[model samples]
Target: MSQEKLEKIEKAGFVLKPDSPEIRPNYERVREAFESRGIEVLLAERSARMIGEKGMPFERMCVESDFLVSLGGDGTLLSLVRRSYAWHKPVLGINAGNLGFLADVTIEEVETFLDQLFSGEYRIDHRLMIAGHIRKASGAKIEFFALNDVVISSPVTSKMVIVNAAIDGERFNSYRGDGLIISTPTGSTAYNLAAGGPVVYPLTKAFILTPVLAHSLTNQRPLVVPADFRIELDTEKYEAVATIDGQERYDLEEGDVVTIGGAKEGARLLHRKERNYFSVLRDKLHWGERNW
Candidate 1:
């Protein structure tokens, strides 16, 4: 949980779901709602072009706005947060898709949320982010950031991968399976949950290493470590792909090393003051429900 309150939100930058022109009407309605509250709306170039409106550069939008908004599902919110990370502007996600973990606010609730925002009756959550890099065998490097988890998996479905793990410069274990998920607490409910990893509290400062479908007879389970510790993984003999937040990917050769650690600064998310994590879990995961 973050104790930081937003400064007066005079202007807000918005990025809509990509490749969807049908979302224009919803964007208009939300823009009007914000304008009615005396808040200016700035749209990103690509998003505005999709809706047939003039827009500014993304960098400029980030610089000029007090905060940012994502008008889609959790994926859109994730993209916005990662792109505007250098700005450190707080973000609000208005859900235009299914019920989402991060985009908690719905379109119908935008007006009410705006009222709450102006009244200083909102909360901002600071969630952990992953700062990672891949060192290629050729001595080149690729850097990326993720709000969820970093996954290293085999390129072919029939082949399994052997990922050797090291922590803080010490060899630890080798995961021989489909792949491995290096997840932050914020990603515990994503692929991590489906692979039997624990649902750690989002604010917990920890890294979760969960192997997917291990080929070992001995006991192999998810491991949680302090976020400050560095984790290094390399595919021993198999070709692999490294995915960040399930959006971006990079090919990995046999000696390439993938390094992951907690970012210095986390992401800030704006939400209703009454939002509850346990309630979300119950609703989203259908926990404690009798299926007669």
Candidate 2:
């Protein structure tokens, strides 16, 4: 939860869905709306190139703008968040695709939302992010951050992956399954949900460890731990790949160690002050609906 209101949003940076030219009209319309409110709109280079407009570099846009906007689906928003994490700017997601869990604001609501935004009636959420690294056998390290989860899964679907888990340097359990998802509370409704993991509130500070298709007699289940504890995972048998936020991937060798923990700063998300998380869950997941 955010306690302070935004201090007069003047300039906003926009990033559109990749390779989608059909969204140019939507982009123009939204850009007009923001301009009408006296907000200077800065388009990212890639998105501008896709839409045939002049644009600035992404780093420059992030630096000059008061906040960032993602005009696409949840996937687009995820990409924007991860890429702009270094800038530490608040992100606003405009939904143009289906199943908009992270990108909740609809196209129709842009005008009204902008009004609320200017009037300081918007909410900014601090969602936990994953700061992780992969230590290779040759002592090289690859570092990355994720707003969702870090998944360790086998490349071959037929072979089960054996992942050894340790908490703070202490060996705990071994997960022999299709894969393992170490998700944040904000990502509980994604792959974690499909794998039978609980839907945790996005504001909660916790790490969710959910196993996908476990092949064990003990019947392994999803485990939620405090964000402070560091988790280490490695596979000894079959080769595995570690995926960050479902967007980036790194091949893991037998001796490579993957370490995951909460990021120092969480991602700041801008939303409607009146938006309800449970209502979104019900609407998206049909929680209380029953077919007659």
Candidate 3:
């Protein structure tokens, strides 16, 4: 192997999602492939547990690893992206589920993917992130970041909630609805799309505000905002909750305020050579040539 090729392969450390049964077997196969060639393998804590790994902190595994691999669907890829952002590591996604926009590489492609990766045949794309700071009138503050979206909504069975949103400290709009989604361009295809938001290009530098099942017909559409603006939502008069990436949740009380903006750091994602956004859309949504 060439000096640069060996350097690239030797410098990589892998991070895999633990829940998938396929990951353990695939991990072993990949481990053997690398070990046979004298390359090192680093595993995330949760993944280590699944593979019977012991004697290392999970965070340390990520910090030491150069390339992290997420071995599941889009959600797994999202979690890995957040971890990579926190650790400043780049991530590769291997899809094992349906609608895997992020995790596009299939199991059959793993070996070839790794080879291309070491040979510098792939490209890395950085996706924008959103950070939110929530405060209550009583003086408590909480901070969170998301690769997908930050959602603010009322508890199940609760009445419609009212929110006053401001962009760049100026009054943007007051919404009377079930909830609101503040999504990154990468997330425009996720929950935002289901909520009627436009499918923005992944590389677009913009934010989307999509209302969920609004009570009023006039408030039915989604709003796209500039990525650099600061967005604030005042829920001081309503009962609500806040969520990030559909994983973390926080309760909202009267007089509580939530602020969201573009994050200084973003996620670096590795894309396979054959992956295409329009191709995925056409295949997943069945958008072409109807026989009926």
Per-model CA lDDT versus the true structure? 0.93, 0.93, 0.77
Residue-wise C-alpha lDDT for candidate 1, range 1-292, written one tens digit per residue: 5667888789999999999999999999999999999999999999999999999999999999999999999899988988899998999999997778999999999999999998888999999999889999999989898999999998888579999999999999999989999998889999999999999999999999999999899878999999999999999888899988888989999989999988899999999999999899999999999999
Better of 1 and 3 by lDDT: 1
Clashing pairs in 3: 236-255
TM-score for candidate 1, please give it.
0.98
Give the per-residue lDDT of model 3 (tens digit) for 95-204: 76565778888777777877777667777777889878898779989988898999888877547877789999999777788888999989888888888888888877
Worst 10 residues of 2 by lDDT: 1-10
Q: Model 2 residue 266 lDDT?
A: 96
Instruction: Give the per-residue Cα lDDT of candidate 2 at 33.
Output: 95
What are the runs in model 2 whose C-alpha is more than 4 Å off?
A: none
Q: Global lDDT for candidate 1?
A: 0.93
Clashes of 3: 1
The CA lDDT at 217 in model 2 is 90
Off by over 4 Å in 1: none
- Full-model lDDT, candidate 2: 0.93
- Indicate the TM-score of model 3: 0.90
Residue-by-residue lDDT tens digits, candidate 2, 74-108: 99999999999999999999998774888999889
